[model samples]
Target: MAEKITIFAHVRNICKASIFRICPPCLAALSRILARFHSNTQRQLVLFLNTAHFLTIGVSLALVVAFFLYAVDGRPIKGEDSFASEESEEFLPNVREIVGEIRPGDSLSSSFRSNGVDEEVRESVISAFDGVMNFREMKPNDRYTLTLDNDGTLIKCLYESGPLEVHAIERTPEGSLAAKKLDVALDCRTVKLRGRIESSLFAALAAFKEDAKLVYTFADIFASKIDFNTETRFGDTFELVVEKYYKNNEFVGYGKILVARYNSKEVGPLEGFYFDQGGKSAYFDHRGYELGESFIRSPVPMARVSSGFSYNRRHPVLDIVRPHLGVDLAAPMGTPIMATSDGRVRFAGWKGGYGKQIILDHGGGYQTYYGHLSRFAN
Candidate 1:
């Protein structure tokens, strides 16, 4: 019995020494292997692996197994280096962008709602534009764009009201909404146009793609001398230097007529230059003479003369010989009548033969009369 006890004690001491020496390297390697596993189930799987096979496999092979297990679990490993990465993945939300146009009978609320925006976000957007813009003034074909987060929060919005005006609203860094009005700049370039009167002045201008406003301006500049309704003849030519506005190389509209020249058959040639003096702008001839006249030739534009001035004429209805002093102009009923010259109203009421008449008294011997059956201008 004494000999058996000594042999057992020696074997136990040898086993303890072997375990102490092997644990250090094996524990270090196990910690690295376990470092790749995040969940408890994966760590248990690693422990269940066959011991003989684990000893034969290299560290790279063990790492590959750990990666495969981590992928199947689909959970990120938590460590001191993962806080920033986790936060980055957590804060970014899904975003969506949409553009909407105002149609007939469509309001700002309807536009947002139709685009799948939440009701709460729509109301907040309306409140954001409260004092900045009047939704009632929104016109048809006006466009707007919206940017929203996954939670349906409005992050940014842009409203294009016109070619030159833009309204913008966005969430500020302080978590408050801010709105502003932006004006788009335009590039202005001067262009010269020359055309001859073929059928009519408006037709001639239209052939060259000139704006109708430009034609009206040309007639107004030469209204006193040339009667566009009757005096314009074939082959009469005109030239103009005007301003054209553009944005991003796209034409927008016209600005003003700088210089105008008209060669009329009746009135040889006329040239007008625009000048600003003492905050007042006026058209002048080459000799510095004002082109404006004391009175306009015709009060109504494009009206035909029904009867001319005659010393002795027979009345159509009464069939009596009488003297018609003023010329009679025939026009549509309810058509507006303008004063031939700038003068105060002397009389505006009903007369015997004339239904509704307005008589103006120019200071001198010159006096004009307008007779019609319509309402008077205020």
Candidate 2:
């Protein structure tokens, strides 16, 4: 009953809600129309709508739809229910709005239950927004609003997660809930994050509470030129410009890192800028060279390189001089192994001296070989 206009849930919220009275004779005729309109509906509360029409382009006639009735909130004539003798609430419709932020570790079902939303209504809302969004995927502080009638009939449900995940459910003409994914109007602003590396990049960004993914991405921009572990000095600093998304003045999340710069005392300063070349997206150095080197420096961090790549090397088990093609990294016995980059597994199993090995083909004729006593993902 919030937006009792020609459209369901939307247009009337923008326009002002005004009340005007109709004559007794006109109301009697209007009640008959309402009776026919709600023959199948069983709700005792009756709500009447008001619609206004405007002129179209290139039309001279000024036509106005005048019903002299803003909106009605009265008991239905044929319904077997009752209303209080006091008619003070008869003019205004009863609409209760529930708005809340989804806190961390809080389920939508639990939040709904806490907010006086019925269990049946919660189930129906979840069913309506199933494919549109899984409630489990909604991030902390994501918002939702529910509009219900006096008797707790759901009029509208709005769930907002991000720029692409705005969803709504509204009561249709037939009184069934219909769900739809809405296009969001987003504001993208360039943001800056700067930090001095006292130790690792992760430690530097810990104060800002930035995600590890962003740290990995920021380091990848300088992966080819600078080996962060070996080259980073005590006073090295970094800064970057990133895009942050917002909806209706509320922040959503981070977007692309547009520009990044790393200032090192040893390696000097280097800058990388994001660019869209042709249809592909990649980062470019300040002098217009593509910084497309995406190789992970070391599969195991803080692990010493026991053996470096060499043309001729001693075979440890065989006691002979041969070509050692791969660099061997040594860490603790239970140290977890991680893939250097994304790839499809070409082989996984025992491979002679390689033993319990997994070979990943990273396209472009580049393949990484992981060997020795360790388990790998399928």
Candidate 3:
């Protein structure tokens, strides 16, 4: 009876374990039993290796697919290349053939249309001259010629007649475009000015009530050879005749001074004239001899008046009357100061109150002095 009871208990335990599905010890025992079913250990090791190999291959394939996608879609970064060819063919410049006169009141569009120009070419030509020429003001009988390309583009536009010369450019092969140029041709003119001396050069020039421009012209022409303040006597007089330029009744610029006559109260009258010798223009005396004066009177060379001539002005050290003999030409420093006449340097060194002076001995008791010099001329 006890043996029978043990068998029944074993059967009951197995049924309970199966029903609950929780048999840790049984499962462990089953593993051992299954391990025994394999004939060799090598087979178990082979199974382990197969599982690891599949995992590695799957991960590798995923990485390869990611890399492939990146390579196919990614773009490289490049720098700006201004010299590269443009992609748009529409941006290319157009050159066309044009013959006939473009006049005021003429339709640029209709005219080009009559000439069998393409719509694109006509639009391009009109756009090129849009802000430049007034196409609405064009008159009949006006002569003009244009050469265009298949696209009806203009390369050059020219209008001949009147005070200005016009040149218009529409297209270029390179990436550069230029606006048209209007070269002006002004008429020539004559100008004159007169003045009387009173104590100084600029004061006398101001008395003329002439245009400041005219005075500047007069001074520039004569400054190289004449010293207005010292060399000019108290009762001197100056007269000048010159040539100027005008465009459309407007003053453009001044030319050469035709003639100048200066009469000094003490010094003899000096007459100067401009002459073209061997293709070079120069100021010469009435006798046709070159005025070989060493330097121009004013450093500015323009006709502006000098500041003043003061003796007791202000000596940093002395601070008293030093008797400033020559006039003070308030010009930009380093301006050239020329000798009045051809003479030897009597004294070219520092004088007590003169700072730095150059005294020229004209001989026979005549002498001229220049002080506070930046340098000495050779």
- What tens-digit string does per-residue lDDT give for candidate 2 at 1-378? 332332322223312233334455655554454445453341232332333312221132322222112123443433333343345458677899999788878888888888878888899998888887776678888899999888888899999885678889999999999999888788999879998988777788777887766776677777666766567778899999988788788777778999999998887998999998789998888788888456767665545578888988988899899998887888778666667778999989999978999899999998988899577653
Q: Rate the local accuracy (lDDT) of all candidates.
A: 0.77, 0.74, 0.63
- Residue 262, candidate 3: Cα error in Å is 1.1
Candidate 2 global TM-score? 0.51
TM-score for candidate 1, residues paired by index? 0.56
Q: Per-residue lDDT tens digits of candidate 1, residues 1-378?
A: 453343334333433443233354554454455455555744454445433334545665788899889956866667754676788988878888889999999999988888887888798888989999977789999999999887778899999988876899999999888988877899999999998987788888899887766776777776667667677788999998989999999888778788999898877798888888899888888898888666766676555678878988898888998989888888778655657777777888999878788888877777788887588755
Query: How far is 192's C-alpha from truth in model 3 (Å)?
Result: 3.7
What TM-score does structure 3 among the candidates reach? 0.38
Which residue segments of model 3 deviate by more than 4 Å?
1-182, 198-209, 231-235, 298-327, 331-378
The lDDT of model 3 is 0.63
- Which ten-residue region of model 2 has the weakest summed lDDT? 62-71
> In angstroms, how far off is 223's CA in candidate 3?
3.4
lDDT for predicted candidate 1 compared with the true structure:
0.77
- Report per-prediction Cα RMSD to one decimal: 11.9, 22.2, 26.1
For candidate 2, the lDDT comes to 0.74
